[model samples]
Target: MTDQIVPDSEHRGLVARLPQVPRDLAQLARFDRPIGWWLLFWPCAFGLWLAGAGWQIGLLLWLLLGAVAMRGAGCVYNDIVDADLDRQVARTAVRPVASGRISQTLAWAWLGALCAVGLIVLFQLRWQAQVVALASLALVAAYPFMKRITWWPQAWLGLVFSWGAPVGWIALRGDNWEVLAALYAGCVLWVIGYDTIYALQDREDDALVGIRSSALRLGGRVRGGVTVFYLGALALWGLAFWLLRADWVALLALVPAALHLGWQVASLDPADPANPLERFRANRWAGALVAAACYVVGNA
Candidate 1:
């Protein structure tokens, strides 16, 4: 009944209508906040499109399902690990696990169900892609502890979230390792940038709880930090395009996404509570623009 369940839950009305257990589970998995899955899904699409498999709707659909399930699973795992910490933070205090609305045993069961779906998605991919996807498990497992140990947990997240790039590339063809590296690195910087914006919502709370984040680390200079990361993302993505096609026109495809990132940085207002979340949520569109650019270059 409170926003504490999720700060940016989009389908609150629908979620409110669900049964208590289902609602709690939905809240736990963040189904009401679809942006998490959207963010996860985009890199999968980016790698697929940029690897010349953009037209493989079947594969893309499978990856989307995988993203939804895996992102949910990751959140559940994170909440389980951070329940104590979440209780100390305003934004996450009412989460199912943190607030005791859902027991950890049940939460673990929920996690298993989500991972089951992820497993189904995994079986749909080729062995090389499957291996690439599975390699992320260790990263995922270690991510919840990063904030405790490092100021750059977002960097760890960048690696985990952007694993889809290589998976997509390897799914179609195993060659061209440089292009995949560049694309994956670009996605990593993009994750760091957008996630820094998302972290702004929790900076004050994070600091109080001793949780480190790029938002808290950058303090007043978060906007500038984001600008630098976004610029780096564009540069690396351009490098990926050039490596693949070596055409000036191929680089032009990134212009739309570049302008969009510029707008995000220009309009960013970290002091305003709403601005960071709005800018953060807008990245679904940014991801789409980047994917389109990838398609133009990779499939041209």
Candidate 2:
């Protein structure tokens, strides 16, 4: 049972302690990997902070809950839709759905339950935020099929995952569409860059199974591709800050995050199997740095 756990699970011990059924369910939802939810939540923070909403503790916590629930639900749905493909991928073969530890029926049930939690979080938001949040459902539903039809599925994931920025921004205020657009665009590129790094882990397996990804599409130039995406993200974020406040000091807030992204790109080693996942996980901190920048620039 312990050996069945995924290679990237961060809470193997706690997950291992659970009984078989619950453990499988937890793995199905990727609760063992909190990084997914953190990545989802940070963009919400970026939107809120950059909207000049100062430390909205209650709303932030609610958004955090939504991120965890919705991200889990998204994973469950993805696994169900991609069960056959997942089985062919070495790293994903152990997934509960792919391994048949959980039936599709049960997986759908669990997905509904997780979405129920997201529904509760939805009710906490204003009507505009609610509408903005609900509008992402179509993109989320279509995301699972993207890998089959498109080499750049990460771009679709970007649209879905970076949605919280607009929701958070609209939740606070309806003005400043330009700043919000810039922020959201930056988030989309950031997701593309990080998710491309993540796709490096499955490039060979993906090719074998006919699954497409930006990493596979980029071939030997993956490092340069990710560099381009990251640079675009930073440039858009800088534009957002300038639109919000023309002061030169506002641009300095992004320097730390810029340096962090630079480091990730500089040290990236796509040849080593382990290096890509490490770099991908490091984006959690990168997200934090960007959130801090958002707070400083928005609040200043």
For all predicted structures, in order, the TM-scores are 0.98, 0.99
Q: How many steric overlaps are in each model, in order?
A: 0, 0
Q: Return the top candidate by TM-score.
A: 2
Q: List the residue pairs that clash in candidate 2.
A: none
Model 1 steric clash pairs: none
Model 1 TM-score is 0.98
Q: Write the per-residue lDDT of candidate 1 for residues 1-300, one digit (tens) a residue.
A: 555447678888899888888999999999999898998999888889898855899999999999999999999999999999999988788899999989999999999999999999999999999999999999999999999999999999999989988988888999989999999999999999999999999988898889999988898899899999999999999999999988898999999999999999999998899998999999999999999998888888
Q: Report lDDT (CA) for all predictions.
A: 0.92, 0.96
Residue 4 deviation, candidate 2, in Å? 1.2
Tens-digit lDDT track of model 2 for 107-211: 999999999999999999999999999999999999999999999999999999999999989999999999999999999999999999999999899999999
Q: What lDDT is obtained when candidate 1 is compared to the true structure?
A: 0.92
Residue 211 lDDT (model 1): 95
